[model samples]
Target chain A: AQSVSQHNHHVILSEAASLELGCNYSYGGTVNLFWYVQYPGQHLQLLLKYFSGDPLVKGIKGFEAEFIKSKFSFNLRKPSVQWSDTAEYFCAVRSFMNRDDKIIFGKGTRLHILP
Target chain B: GAGVSQSPSNKVTEKGKDVELRCDPISGHTALYWYRQSLGQGLEFLIYFQGNSAPDKSGLPSDRFSAERTGGSVSTLTIQRTQQEDSAVYLCASSTRLGGLFFGEGSRLTVL
Candidate 1:
């Protein structure tokens, strides 16, 4: 079975601090990766996605993720985070199984950015 | 609708009662999915529907949980004799041709 692991459960960072949330998946086939964010009192929205091509994918709100195939990792990063960036982040992967493809999500990381 | 929509944004029901949650996917989307979010479990995939048929119902936890999509548009999840442990936020998402999904606001079900 395919599974996603997020190493950080909660992260507290001051405004303008660098951010990196670790995400690793267990799969051997071709995969599509994604990062979703859930702001307080809001629905989950796509932050970024990595299907093919370049390893580095930039998303909305100054977010970016890198898909390192060798490490089986797709980590989310931000050069400098703001107070408004406080939200729960989820890392997901959809493995291609010939026909049945389903997305599996990690436990999620709660990020608290202090202003 | 411009985006996915879920009804009864919040629902509270007694244990052993039945509950039905509705989800209307985005227009022209052919794929729909159901997921559950809980404090303990985070997020989990419950089912996926392609058109009006379900190709994957493997994530459903028990026989009491069932779901169906009709007209390839709306979906309803039914839970019979709901248990307190079943309390969680039920989320619906839709996609086109196996691409990124668009999620609804979700329906929070509290079993007391």
Candidate 2:
């Protein structure tokens, strides 16, 4: 039952508001974490990823995610939001066991930034 | 092509009917993947291919769902005896260097 979980289905915030999206995974070994975004009428694009090294990884468009191994969480955060940031965000996981290389994705979170 | 290309941006078929969706991954990309996206379920991994060979097919929902890749370029996902629950946007992606993926617009299937 190893899977990714996104805490929010929908979120609304005004421009310049701080944003935080929760993502957690249940897995037993070393894993890779990622965040992807799909803009309206656009294909899904990689926002950022965490493989190793520093737990905090920065990505495009002023987005960053902190991987907390103890908590099994990789939460996405942004200091300020923009109207253009309105889109669907997905959390994904990839385990490195080498037997199964499936990359599982969470349900996703829809963010609406009001101007 | 510049990115992954999926045919039939939208498809509507009757229940129990079989449908085929095609994906042309970026040239030289050895890794290709298929995923199902729906309202409730965000992204359901269906299959993965590496150089015309499938290493993982565990994510396929049932025996009715099958996929194949040819020449390490084009892939086809076949759904046999489709059900209403099969209505979803099917996404295809090709992995670039360093594990970054390039996605297609998706083929949206609507089973009536």
Candidate 3:
């Protein structure tokens, strides 16, 4: 079974600090990577996705992730975080085998930005 | 209506009782999915429905859990004789053939 791992369980940082969340997956085939953000009292929304081509993918809210195939990692990063950025971030992956679109999500990382 | 819609945003039921969670996927979506998100845990895939084909229920945790999609649209996930361990947020998502999933607010189920 394929799985995703998020290194950070809970992260607390002051506003304007840099943010980097680590994510790694266990799969050998071609996969689609994604980052989903769940704001307080909101649904899970797509932040970014990597299908093919460029390894570096930029998403909304100034978030970007790099897909390192060698490491089986797709880490999300933000240059400067804001107080509003406090939320739970999830890293997910979907394999292309047989065109099965079942997506697997990592145990999210809870981020709290203090003002 | 607009995005995926899940009914009963929060549901609290006694252990051993049955509970049903509803999901209304986006219009014209061909793929619907069910996932469970427990506290401090990652999203657990429950089932997947694509078009009129048989659903992929491989992810369902146990025989107590089952789901169905009607008319290729709305879906219902029913947990029979729910246990306390079944407490989690049940999320429904829909997508186009090759599009990113659009999720609902999710239905929080608390079994006590």
Candidate 4:
């Protein structure tokens, strides 16, 4: 069974601080990685995804993630954060070969950005 | 086409009752999915549908949970004899192949 793990359950940081959320998956096959964000009262939206390409992928809102195959990890990062960035972040993965693959999501990291 | 849409933004049902949650996927999208998110447990994949076929039911937590997609477009997830543990927000998402997914606002179910 494939699964994703988010190391930081909850993180609090002041504005302008750097942010990084750790994500690791348990799988030994071709995988598609993704990061989704949920605002205070909005639906889950795709931040970015990694199908096949460079290890580092930049997403909307100055967010980025690096896929490290050796470690089975895809960590999300943002050089500078804002209070509006306070939201829940989820990491998901699906096997590439599976045409109708079921995406497995991490428990999620709740980021609270202080003003 | 519009993104995925779910019915009954919120549902409150009594225990032992049956309830159906609906999901309308984007037009032309061949893939649809169902997931549940509890307060702190993150999102859990409940089912997946591709062109009216479900190749995987392994993610379903129990026999009480079942889902079906008709015409490869609309889907219904039914929970029989709902329990308090079944309380959570049911989310529906659709994809244009295996790419990024567009999600609905979700239907929050509360079983008492």
Candidate 5:
């Protein structure tokens, strides 16, 4: 079994302020990491994902995450956030070793961006 | 379908009543998942279907909750004798073996 842990439950940031949400996972084998976002009154959509290759991965809306294997972390970061970025973000993981293993989600971080 | 589709966008039912939520996955997706999203709980996975067979149903909260998929396309989640605590958004997502999920708008159920 695999699990995800999000360090922050809620985050408040002002417009143009930098943001970082920490995420860690517990899995012993190969895995695929993902970041999903849900805007107010909207469905959850993919922000970004890391399968392999470079540690840093860029996503939509100028968001990015770095997969650091040593720390078991894949933290989401934004250089400058906008008010429209307010939403709930979830970190998820799936086992690449077991194709049947279902993806697991963290508790989620609710981000509030002030104008 | 162009994307995952869930039905009964909103449902208000009395306690003890039964409810059924439907999910139609994106065309040709081999993996389908059902999740429950409540305030503060994030996404609580309820079940996973690989094709028409479910391999992991451990996330289902209770026996009153049941789900099934047919022809590897449409899935239905049934809650028998629903309780007030069962009120939440039931979300359905579809994906390939290694692809990210494509989520539906979700079916919100409110038990009174």
Candidate 6:
């Protein structure tokens, strides 16, 4: 079993501001990490994911995340955020035990981007 | 030209009633998942189906909740004797190999 923890419940940022959301997981074995975004009135969409390669991964809309294995963290970051970035972000983890392991999701961070 | 699709975008049922939500996964996805999203809450895993077998039902909150996938494509989530607490957005997602999920618009269930 795996679990994910998001440090921030809500975040507010002005336009063009740099944003970073903290995410941590509690899995000792190999795992797959993902960040999903759900915009207002929209379904959950995958932003990015890390399976077994580089720690740094880039996603749609200029978003990125760094997988720090030592810290058990995979934090989402963006150099500059726009008003359209307002959405709820979730961090998820899937252990490598079974090919179809269940993904554990965090409580999600509601991001409000003000112009 | 296809993605996951769920039926009855909104479902309203009385307490203690039975409700069934449907999901049509992507054409070739081998994995399907069901999740519940409460107002201002995170997505809670309900059940998972890989192909035709479900290895984990631990995410189901109670025995009243059950789900099944047939032909490894379409899925149905049935909640028996539903409660008011079940009022939330029931989401369905499908993945080609459990890496990235393509989600449906979701079926919003309101237990009144």
Worst 10 residues of 1 chain A by lDDT: A96-105
The digit string of per-residue lDDT tens for model 3 on A1-115 reads 7889999999999999999999999986899999999988888999999999999999999999999999999999999999999999999998876767678899999999999
Total clashes in model 4, counting residue pairs 3 or more apart in sequence or in different chains: 0
By DockQ, is 5 or 6 better?
Answer: 5
Give per-residue CA lDDT, model 5, range B1-112, as digits (tens). 6999999999999999999999999998999999999999999999999865645798999999999998888999999999999999999999996689999999999999
The native-contact fractions of the candidates, in order shown, are 0.53, 0.76, 0.88, 0.85, 0.76, 0.91
Residue-level lDDT for A94 in candidate 5: 89
Q: For residues A18-101, what per-residue lDDT tens digits would candidate 2 score against the true structure?
A: 999999998868888999999999999999999899999999999999999999999999999999999999999887665555
Each prediction's TM-score versus the true structure: 0.97, 0.94, 0.96, 0.96, 0.97, 0.96
RMSD in Å for model 2: 1.6
- For candidate 1, state the interface root-mean-square deviation in angstroms to 1 decimal: 0.9
Residue A17 of model 2 has an lDDT of: 100
After superposing candidate 2 on the true structure, give the runs of residues whose Cα lies further than 4 Å from its correct spot: B96-98
lDDT by residue (B36-88, candidate 4, tens digit) is 99978999888887775644777789999999888788889999999999999
lDDT of 2 at B76: 97
Give lDDT: candidate 5, residue A44.
98
Model 1, A39-87: lDDT tens digits are 9999999999999999999999999999999999999999999999999
lDDT measured at residue B86 in model 1 versus the true structure, 0 to 100 = 93
In angstroms, how far off is B78's CA in candidate 4? 0.4
**Ten-residue stretch with the least lDDT total in model 5 chain B:** B49-58
| Residue-level lDDT for B91 in candidate 4 | 97
Model 6: CA > 4 A from native: A98-100
Per residue, candidate 4 scores C-alpha lDDT tens digits across A8-82 of 999999999999999999886899999999998899999999999899999999999999999999999999999
lDDT of 3 by residue, B1-112 (tens): 8889999999999999999999999999999999999889878899999898899898899999999999999999999999999999999999987678999999999999
Over all chains combined, what TM-score does candidate 6 have?
A: 0.96
Q: Which candidate model has the greater lDDT, 1 or 6?
A: 1
Worst ten in a row by lDDT for model 3 chain B: B92-101
Query: Each model's DockQ?
Result: 0.74, 0.78, 0.88, 0.87, 0.88, 0.86
TM-score for candidate 2, please give it: 0.94
